[model samples]
Target chain A: DAGITQSPRHKVTETGTPVTLRCHQTENHRYMYWYRQDPGHGLRLIHYSYGVKDTDKGEVSDGYSVSRSKTEDFLLTLESATSSQTSVYFCAITQLLAGGRNEQFFGPGTRLTVL
Target chain B: DQQVKQNSPSLSVQEGRISILNCDYTNSMFDYFLWYKKYPAEGPTFLISISSIKDKNEDGRFTVFLNKSAKHLSLHIVPSQPGDSAVYFCAARIFGASGTYKYIFGTGTRLKVLA
Candidate 1:
């Protein structure tokens, strides 16, 4: 297992409230990603960071945002929690070897519920 | 439109039987494919992978076959065990493009191994 941890493994918030999920990794990996898993949707990328202060939006980035101010931390925030945003969120870090085989290691996950 | 699709939402297999999971993709640019397994309450973990250059790759009890002409891939688990019961996701990555290493995942198929 990777030395990755997600804060507040479980959270429940109300609609229109702001919620932030934090992902911290002991490994100084250069690539970090955030994904949400929902029924019939498997895992969808929410946002990802390639380096400190460098982030990009994914296919489902409409309702989410991410930031990576340091090498070991990546944060995902929901500006206003919605019922549709309730799901299991996972943080992952990618390690690329010289052969270009990029393997991703995942955190346990964070379960968020919006009422 | 979903670039990757896992048509079968679930599958069941008896212990010591062969389990087959299928996946299809619509993007021609996707050249690398991978399979990941996930148990409830945990994040997905990499299982096996096959590059587009090769049609097949095997690791122990797991084998991945790719059909580029059909734009499909399948994962076969021989002599399935109860421990193998989990949700399987098919993912792909497009190369030759900057920042395209992000994976596109299928909805996933839940596999159950009955003892």
Candidate 2:
């Protein structure tokens, strides 16, 4: 909850529909990450951005896309939502500190349900 | 395949007792490990982290022990408090080809501190 906020705290959507989740940070951190949490899968990173316009895939990048247009905003878009994607989504921000310490701060989270 | 695994799905410990949560990783390239605590409806917050070069790291009543040879890590909380009851996640960081680190998280262990 450190200076991070996720939009649409809860959402109910239909399968095959497109959905976009927003993450805003006031901390001005350089790195932002999108993750999904499920019952058996703790938290799987979907994508992360190191800087504006610089994004990369994560372990579970399939069926998800991300964009960072500004330093404070990172967006995660589900091009075609699926029932398998129904999970709690979280956004986290982090800055590289001295000695290579990277501690991420997370938003409250967005619960998305795909029917 | 899951690189990080937390076999225990839930754990309960009495107040003033020690609670130990364990995690194992299959990847040897991981350079750092971290612990995060999550509440019912909130995003995860960073609790502690340890570099691969270190065997143990401690802060206040929480201590993390890493065994590189066994590919195991454990978090120990002394005098567990009700406030400490939550889902604990274990994550491992590996350096990516893009010069950034990617994190892989375990399924998580839910800890309940009985009052």
Candidate 3:
């Protein structure tokens, strides 16, 4: 809770609808990540950005897209919602240090349900 | 295939006792590992981390041990409290060529401390 906030704590939408979830952070960290958590599966990274305008896909990037236009904001979008995409989404940030250690901070999370 | 795995879905421990949670990874390139705790409807909070350079790292009641040869790690919480009851996740990161990094997480282990 140190400065990260996720919008729309809970959402319900129909399949095939486009949905977007927003994650905002006040820490101004350099790295931001989007992840989804589901039963029997740990949190899987959906997308991540290293810097503004620099974004990349993660292990489960299908149907998901992310944009980081600024240091404090990272947006995750689903072009077409599906029941399988119903899960808890989390946003995380990390600051790289000269040393090898980097600690990540997470947001409260947004729960999405596709009907 | 899952790069990170947490076989135990849940663990129970008596208050003031020790609780151990295990995690395994299939990726050999991973050099950093971390543990996080999450409560109901909340995002994961950073707990502890260990690098391949060290086999163990401890902070107060929590200790993390890494076994690189076995690609395994475990978290030990001494004097487990009811407040410690939550889901724990293990994560790994591999640094990419361009100074970018990505995390892979295990499913998670729900820990219950019975008073």
Candidate 4:
């Protein structure tokens, strides 16, 4: 909700197919993160970018890839979509709050279903 | 293995009453902890946080208490309202080898404040 938007609020894809979710921000923040939320698992980071053209893997990076070519956009791509990858994806940007600590603000979310 | 764990799956509390959410972490290296609140179809929002140096932190209606010896933290909401009904997730940060901090989240506990 903090100047962040994620495209395709709801998406349905088939297994073995590829899916890419887009995250765009107007804040021009330096950090962007991709995460997935499942029923049992809260939210697991898929990838994060510290700056443009710079990215790093998270705990659950398998079957997922990320690209950040521009300062305002970060993309998450599932090379081969699987049922296990079906979850609500969220994009977040980090900023330093008044408390002098970094806090993350998230986009609404994109619900991806793989059948 | 889950480094951060929230044992309660769900909790129901009446309006104007108090609600308590608990979280535990296994990683001793984690010195900072945060609490996030998520509504349906929305992204998780930062709530309150406590550092290892402080045993408690309070912000208006929400309070976070930390116990270093027990490696546990609890969120307390006084006079819980229906609007407060949502899922809460606990997160922990561990310094990564890449010089960037990585956050690990718990499974989450759904809170339903009855009107």
Candidate 5:
């Protein structure tokens, strides 16, 4: 386990409502990522943070924004929730193994339903 | 365009059989590949991974095989068990802008191991 946790295990909200999801990591790893899982698209990257206050957009970052104020916390916000935005969001941290190869450890995930 | 693709959406295998899941990628620059197994309503867990320099990496019953020329990789689970049933995803690590490496994931293939 990478000591990753996501808030709001399940939620239901109306369209246009704003929502925020939090990811907390106890490992203090330098790299953190947010991804969404959809039935046909699989897991699509939404955003990532290389360090505190350093963030980058992922392929599917159109309606989402992210922030990292501390090494242990990363937050993802949906400015206006849409039906298309409903998904299971995952948080992950990268870990380097002895062979110099890296792998990501994921959180429990948050299921959001936009009505 | 999707750089990583898992053409098969589902597969079924008899218990104590071998289960193979395939993934294809378009980019040759991907330096690392990983496989993740996810159960319903839970986060994905790392199954196994292979570096670009190696053709195969095995961990117990899970083995990952990479073909650099074909940009293809596959996960082989030997002596499949009922507990091995889950949605499997393949991800490739690519160097993105700002010296950050991003993971591109396939749509996933659901494996159902029958008893």
Candidate 6:
């Protein structure tokens, strides 16, 4: 929904290798976010961008970094893949509506496996 | 530790019955709460939301009830259908020290609606 799409929907990388996931949106929404989903952990935010080049870290940003050099693109990079980082990654966009309330729309997702 | 919590890991319901999912939060300052539904191999989709100022919000067969005092929230789906089976996530939005809004999410609750 929200015209969001994620690249390389499935990937497998070895330990110590680097991997980057791409998130693309066509709606031009102002907020973009990266999150990882694991069993019993729900969805944990890794990073979010309010505008181009205005990215900030989330609670689970320890092993991940993000960049948003354009309005439609947000990327997440794992410096070195680890087994603990093996999870399904999701990209989301928050539509800030009137009255300062907002709702988030998400992309299909990317499944990453680190061995 | 997670700020948002969904204690129940899974639930099973009969078709045409009401399915109730519960969520709790440790942070009382969250002003906005939302519920999202996710199917296998897909990202989550926004379902409904309730503001801290309001205790209840409804949209057709789905209703969200909030108790600010107890820091609890629940989602109700009437006449549950087989397609209604999915993982539900509760998200809480709170303003951060940097003046930006941050969302905290619960682990998730999987609901199985039997035909």
- Using DockQ as the measure, the top candidate is 5
Chain B TM-score per candidate, please: 0.96, 0.98, 0.96, 0.98, 0.99, 0.98
TM of each candidate vs. truth: 0.96, 0.97, 0.96, 0.95, 0.98, 0.97
For candidate 3, what is the DockQ-based docking class? high
C-alpha-based local distance difference test score of model 3: 0.93
lDDT of 5 by residue, A5-100 (tens): 999889999999999999999987999999999989999999999999999888899999999999999999999999999999999999977986
Model 4 agreement with the true structure over A16-66: per-residue lDDT tens digits: 999999999998899899999988988999999889988889989999999
For model 3, how does the per-residue alpha-carbon lDDT over A16-52 read when each residue is reduced to its tens digit? 9999999999987889999999889889999999999
Candidate 2 lDDT score at position B102: 77
- Which digits, one per residue and each the tens of the lDDT, describe model 4 over residues B11-93? 99999999999999998999688999998888999998887888999999999999999999999999899999999999987
lDDT of each: 0.91, 0.93, 0.93, 0.92, 0.95, 0.93
Candidate 4 docking band:
high
- Model 3 alpha-carbon drift over 4 Å, by segment: B96-99
Give a tens-digit lDDT track for model 3, residues B1-115: 9999999999999999999999999989998999999998889999999888899999999999999999999999998999999999999998755568999999999999999
Residue ranges of candidate 1 with Cα displaced over 4 Å: B95-100
Error of 2 at A24 (Å): 0.6
Model 5 agreement with the true structure over B23-69: per-residue lDDT tens digits = 99998889999999999988999989999999999999999999999
Which segments of candidate 5 are over 4 A away from where they belong?
Answer: none
RMSD of 4: 1.3
Shift of residue A78 alpha carbon in model 3, Å: 0.8
Question: Candidate 2, DockQ to 2 decimals?
Answer: 0.86
Q: Sort by DockQ, best first.
A: 5, 2, 3, 6, 4, 1
lDDT (Cα, tens digit) per residue for candidate 6, span A1-115: 9999999899999999999999999999888999999998899999998899988889899989899999999999999999999999999999988876789999999999999
**Can you write out model 2's per-residue Cα lDDT over A1-115, one digit (the tens) per residue?**
6689999899999999999999999978888999999998899999999899999999899999999989999999999999999999999987677897778788999999999
RMSD in Å for candidate 1, one decimal? 1.4
